[model samples]
Target: MPQSVDRALDVLDAVAASDGPVPAKALARRLGCGLSTVYELLGTLTARGHLVRTPAGYVLGYRVPSLHLAFQRQMRMSGEVQELLHRTRRAAGVDTYFSTYRDGGIAVLAAATASHPATGGFTVGQDTTGHATAHGKVLLAALPRAARLRYLAASGMRAITPHTITSPERLDVQLRRVRHEGVAVEVEECAPGVACVAVPVPAAGAPTAVSAALPLEEFHRRGHQVAEALRQVAAEAATFQGTADISGSTGG
Candidate 1:
């Protein structure tokens, strides 16, 4: 890829990852590039309507929503599957996510959350912290042993929290358990105060998983209920013909 395009993408990623609008100086610092180069990229992106400048700084522009809608359409997430996710959120009383492993990465295809959401970190796109997320664990557990090892080698097990299992050996043990039980659970691994439970979405023609996240204390209190709800949703999603194409052309 061209250096200019690469820098532009890095700028977009940095802004998306930020909690709020990011100043141009901060973007330059984050990208380890000169102020002039960053400003040039920002100006082009803003003119293209990919980024919008605010009094505070820059945020994603109007074009992003259309891109997101196009992405959702390309994913082929049917109404039935989306409804199932929403139903799981209501039944499980937690934020729900639908995800799949493709091209050696995990992507969250859909999510349903209540007015007061529980999980805070999940976003659409490639999720890099597979080692610390239940949805990622379920997808990782489905890979062939060699492929799984290769993916782990490429995406190091960075510890997101103290409870995260950073050691590959330890993670392998958990993956084996996930494969055997067809479920994955993580407590305060992905984020502080958050616990997640996930189950494989059978017959989805990809390494797909449906997960629910809630407060750690609430998870402990109603973990079994949440897991059961996720299983039910996964089973229903498996029956949707549209789900067969959810992975699209992306290889598992």
Candidate 2:
């Protein structure tokens, strides 16, 4: 029963992650399950109003929106936190982000680009590459030891850029340094000319991190200032809850 439940949830996640309606066969391949199993689960989910079948394939049902709305409301971060991100953007003169580590993935909840906007485009709903992102490193480092190991094993270090960490052993060392230093820094790791610095928020619910991205030149010159600004925000914000235990998976 537990295994069935996991597969059902996996099906839902796959559908959600997809750009459009997904076929049963595709889902089976994605989940590594037989067609019969996927068809049965899809039927059950569609019947239960958790999925909606379309001409092309299946998408989330109406019920999913309400659930998403509810989750958003539950995670409605404080105005102060939002303001802090904005302030950080202005202070650092770069694009700023508020992210949470959930389900073994980094979910960008809020982003602010002030007068000095960054060249790269990133925003909410984007599941960032953990192996190449400072925010990802902070959150990944905060995971429980066992879960972190499981996540690392499952998440192959895919190289987004030539500078991206591709070795698990090297990444493990980097994560330890991030934890010890209480900060994460990435220089041209995710993108050629983009650099990022992140610091953990230590929120009540989930492990949250705040980050600022800038051009490589600016990041090199004022990275410490950005980190300080993020630390100030983390210091002043009231405690909040939403982050749950680490999910034993790695992000895409």
Candidate 3:
């Protein structure tokens, strides 16, 4: 690939991978490039509308979906999910999202914040444990059973909360259920008092999952109904499920 464009994209990735806007200098170190190169990349991407400058620093832009839409809707469905989350927050009360595969985990492609009546909570760029998250598991379910078994064995599902599946056996069971339901749930897993319901947004070009997270207390009160709402919202998003290819396979 062209080095300039690659560097520009690297900067964009760094921003997307963070919970908040990231400074150009920090982006420089992570990409193992010089400050000037980082700024140049940031400047270029921002100019092209892929990024924006914020008080926190630089963040992936909300317009990303529209830019990637039409041309690579399949590949860019993830961004549409984010855009949907941002909009759904108005209806579902925010706290909704779309996630995609990244570095053996799920990346937040889009999110809306109705998580609280106020501000200050997990940001849009957060990445959660694949096994622990309801949405994450939905994507995980797409993996071949044989490969899924191996991933769980090595990942050694951790106990994020009492509700989390800490064993391979239990995790496997949950994944099976997710496959059947076409949705996943995180009840106090990944974070205390946090729960999520998710559905797969299948796009062969750029596949991801659509999820809605809420305070655990609220989730228990509304998980079932919200799961349906999530489904409806997903209907508005693109469907993309490419062939299964979990990055690193291991033995179960």
Q: What are the Cα lDDT values of the candidates?
A: 0.85, 0.77, 0.68
| Model 1 stretches with alpha carbons more than 4 Å out | 19-36, 54-56, 114-120, 248-252
Model 1 over residues 77-174: C-alpha lDDT tens digits? Answer: 67687788887777657888889887777889888887433374787678888889999999889888777777788888888899999998899899
Native-referenced Cα lDDT, model 3? 0.68
Candidate 2 C-alpha lDDT tens digits along 140-210: 88887776666666666788889999887798899999999999999988888989988887643667788
TM-score of model 1 relative to the true fold? 0.84
Candidate 1 residue-pair clash tally = 0
Q: Using lDDT as the measure, which candidate wins?
A: 1
What TM-score do all the candidates reach, one by one? Answer: 0.84, 0.64, 0.60
For model 3, residues 1-252, the per-residue Cα lDDT tens digits are 498877887777778778788988788889999998788778878888889998878988866866545423433343455566677878767377666664444556555775342121344444545778876688778776665655566566777677777777777788889888788887777777677788876543333677877777777788888888887777777532221221222222
TM-score (C-alpha, index-matched) for candidate 3? 0.60
Total backbone collisions for each predicted model: 0, 4, 9
For model 2, the superposed segments whose C-alpha errors exceed 4 Å read 1-71, 114-120, 126-128, 238-252
- Residue 252 lDDT, candidate 1, scale 0-100: 31
TM-score of 2: 0.64
Instruction: Point out the worst 10-residue segment of candidate 3 by lDDT.
Output: 242-251
